[model samples]
Target: MKRYQAVRGGTGDLTKPDVNTRVQDNLYLAVNSKWQKDAVIPADRTEIGVNTAIDMRIEKRMMSDLDKMVSDNKVPAIKNLDKAVTLYKIAKDFAKRNKDGAAPIQADLKKLDALKDFAALNQDANELDEVYGLPFGFEVEADMKNTKVHVLEFAGPGTFLPDTTSYKQEDASKLLAILQKQTVKLLTMAGMSEEKAEKYVAAGLKFDQKLAKVVKSTEEWSDYPATYNPYSLSDFLAKIKSFAMRDFLKELLPALPDKVIVMEPRFLDHFEKLINPDNFDEIKGWMVIKFINGLSSSLSQEFREAGFPFSQALSGQGELIPQERHAYYVANGVFDEVLGIYYGKKYFGEEAKADVTDMIKKMINVYEDRIQNNDWLSENTKKKAIVKLRALVLKIGYPEKEKKIYDLLQVDPAKSLYENEKALSKITTKYAIDKLTKPVDRSVWLMPGNMNNACYDPQRNDITFPAGILQAPFYDLHQSRGQNYGGIGATIAHEISHAFDNNGAKFDEFGNMKNWWTDADFKEFNKRTQAAIDIYDGLSYGPSKLNGKQVVAENIADLGGLTCAIQANKVDKGSMKELFENYARSWAQKQRPEAIKTEIAVDVHAPQPTRVNIPSQCQDEFYETFDVKPSDGMWLDPEKRVRIW
Candidate 1:
């Protein structure tokens, strides 16, 4: 111990192993030690061995039970098929009862025939292949029939409670009749013949009736609750706290959390001076605005360089852009360049230009009204909201100009794919460098005008509906206002609700990062939001579980959008039940398991089943429309249900 030793490089006694030798020796010792440890343990050890044995025995018992059930059944793989048959039978009966005209029913019959063919094909597949290869085949075939049933249920007499007195069951029928009459009146007012109006009404009635039958059939297979589970309350509260805590922590820690970070010092400097010091708690607020500006510029450059036709990129192609950044560009005038290209003399000709301008003006009016009338917002915030709404410069159809960013990079059609990629990289880098010194340009479009989606920008506090989404299923001049509102109106409501969602709530009407809520008001808002979190957390879907905390913001938007759309329809004297049903129908979809798994991890929106079922539980209109009872599968406890507007 008294002897001096050099720890870094000097060797010790010859009896000891060297560093590398010692490492090898230690590894060997570890292997031998593990073996000895295992050898010392008895095979019959009660603690670990008994538990595993018990688990295996229980699993065996369950498997045996399942095997018995499968063997006893004549059609072991036919549960979905049986459900489809039952739905088809219900549709046939409904058709018979409402046989004013048979065209729609005949169409349903054709669908049933197709289902039968698919089922037969499934039956012929081997058990091994069926189990592993075709698990989704049955569901895919059944969904076709289910969708039809869903549509039918919306149009018919609807449902009634056998014992309770709420609204008259006949009121729904009376409403439908009135709707038919008014539709005819409106058509006649728009200049259709009496005979043509009658024919149109007949066709419309038939379509609604069939649609209701389809809806009912689909609903039959759904796992909606008859009543809210009291046991779920504890779980719901826990979930709300977890989600809120996580998001709150995320927001507080970074102070400037966003998808992309742009480190442009000049813009950051300008932003810092522009924002009032009292408004921002930290310097990070300025960082966010500058980053967003850079992001918008980057996206605009990318779109411009792609050299794709304007309509193909913006409207028809359905290309997904980074949503957060795209929202910012749409709010600013940055989208004008692309719009000019498509709306000019070369595209759509000049006749449609005036119509396009009128549509844009109407859209702006709707945005302005929404911003001004939001009750939860304070007056100071409302003025800012109004300013932002007014400042949203409209860019209809296509941009009025184009950028030459792509000219920096030459693309040869004959070049190899790798060569083209290198050229693109160079172009992107050059474009980014070019933006470093330029003043922020608001007249750029992040997405093409022809795109089929819409968005709300928290920074700019503006909303945009691209030209692509302006077509069928969203907007159709030939369709009734009820249909158009249910389709496009719901979409508008969805975008507007985003303005108040968790992240969006941080931005003021002027697109500045700030808290505009009073302490009391913020507390109240959190309490209500927590209630929703708890409700959604208890939900189960198939084999996977829902991440309640992750989906709270989007869920809030969904519920709010539905509520807003229903209110809007009521103001227009439209059927509230129809509006609710249509909202549900818009979300009717199917997906592969792999795709669903990916969505769960990355997508902010909840899974399809939860999207449809959870929001419906919050709406009194839905409960009344569908005759849902406290004992029904989809009921929510009165005290536990959350409503925030």
Candidate 2:
């Protein structure tokens, strides 16, 4: 403790404590106040905090290596990695791109222009799905219930606002207005007259406004298990009156399956009206505008600059990312797995990987003990929970096997970036369609190793800690064990806790959606989950308030992760104070107000401060370490604190 005080904290990307602030009153503020003062939201970024700081570093290292590969025109024997280089050159060739302007997409744009009516749309649906990327929404994934075979899932097309709830707000009109202006400008840039562009924009807005009314709200979407509504193939096809749905499916899928999982039953309820003759003009316009906006970056620099304000308003990003960074990110998205493998091999260390794997085991062990002793659950439920805990696959660092899709990628250097992306989209679409009857490969990772994040996929019943997150603030070999545990240990525990969260609880040990809980225990569990919701509900952050129901699962995980980490610390002796401080510090963030509003509207996670303070207040160990008083700002009355693991 004296050594930490003597240092007065490190500089640049490290959280510096504010000595004047008392830990008893505000843990996040006390830890983040000085760092917040020093932190600047980069011109091209909407936020910069703990995660982004690490992300920027990782990006720098990865991009620098990639930059060298491009410069030297060299690549290792890594299979199909040269395709990424091919794409990088294509995307990075701005001189050719600027000269080509919007010429490459003109013929593609003409396809939308030629859509005269519903019949035309039906004929083109498969081609659009291939080239344009699922115009509405349809995905192939491992069945939530079956957990082995892949299933077809069709969902709603949300509006320009993205979040359906935003349409309810009076302030949403301002955002819509921004969209309207940008859409018109982009259309005009694509060689449409101002009058024609206005007509197109108006029609698109009309469709979007109605679509927003019918689509699910962000809160409703937060319930992962409820989305698994299966419809008989015949029954599903009958819902679509106009668009020759039968032929479209036959072309899109390798074989017409027995079922179609309707992800948005409500959206499907109004499907015919939304996609029919009366609304054909509006629907077509919506498709056109969305296609243009989505691929605007693949066009000239002028087109990208034209679409900036709407992006700026939505995320409060001050300026566009440089073309070099933009090119790298675009290429990176397509070849991330390949790059992730290379990145893990080059940047990630074997020692760190082994250490993190051990920490993950400690967290899982603690969870097993917690479940065995959980007062709320019956023994029957306890036994089932332990089975799931033990079965939870830990994918640390990177995957040993690469995805089969990479084997098929053949990027052509002669083609335009837009053309390459379009061709690749079709290839990706075919790969996904081919998976309908195939068994779910549980070994395949949901997240790549290069991302500075971690995830738990309930369907696969696995947790992945990518190599990108195994660094400072999250994990560092040089940092104190308390800091390491509080940083990545809590994160590991967070992913474990997700297995028992409101959504994950619906799935059983085998990753199948089934109720393993006794009726009474399930009820009690929900009561506690509701309590978790109530605490965060309507809590203010900037101009928006959190929807407790929307963020309940993550909040539960945050609390549970903290609880398990605290217990793990009890077994391994460490500074409880440093654990508490670093736990608070890990969530240190600075976000733009616009970004916060957007996050509140759609994201399942609560604001950063909420992640820190709420979980800290819920922990008894936090009180002991900080000497929190009833009078302290961070203090919560014992009864008001929530806990469930």
Pick the TM-score winner. 2
Residues 238-345, candidate 1, lDDT per residue (tens digit)? 332212322322322322111112112222223223223232222121221112212222222322223222212111233333332222223222223332233232
Runs in model 2 deviating more than 4 A are: 1-20, 133-135
Model 2 scores worst on lDDT over the 10 consecutive residues at 5-14
Taking the tens digit of each residue's C-alpha lDDT, what string does model 2 give over 1-645? 211221101111123345566676667778888888778899999998899888888788877877888889899777777888789878988899999998998998877777798777777788776655433677899888888889999998766885988888877889889988998888778887889778878898899988888888889999988898999999998888876888988887889999999988988888888888888888877887788888889988988898788889989999998888888898788988988888888889999888888888988899999999999899999999999999999898888878999988779889899999988877887897799978888899877888899999898889999899988988898988889878998999999999999999999877999999999999999999999999888877777888999999999999999999989988889788888889988898888889988999989998776688788888888888877666666777778889888
Candidate-wise lDDT, in order = 0.40, 0.84
Each prediction's RMSD over C-alphas, in Å, is 34.1, 4.1
Tell me the number of clashing residue pairs for each predicted model.
48, 0
Clashing pairs in 2: none
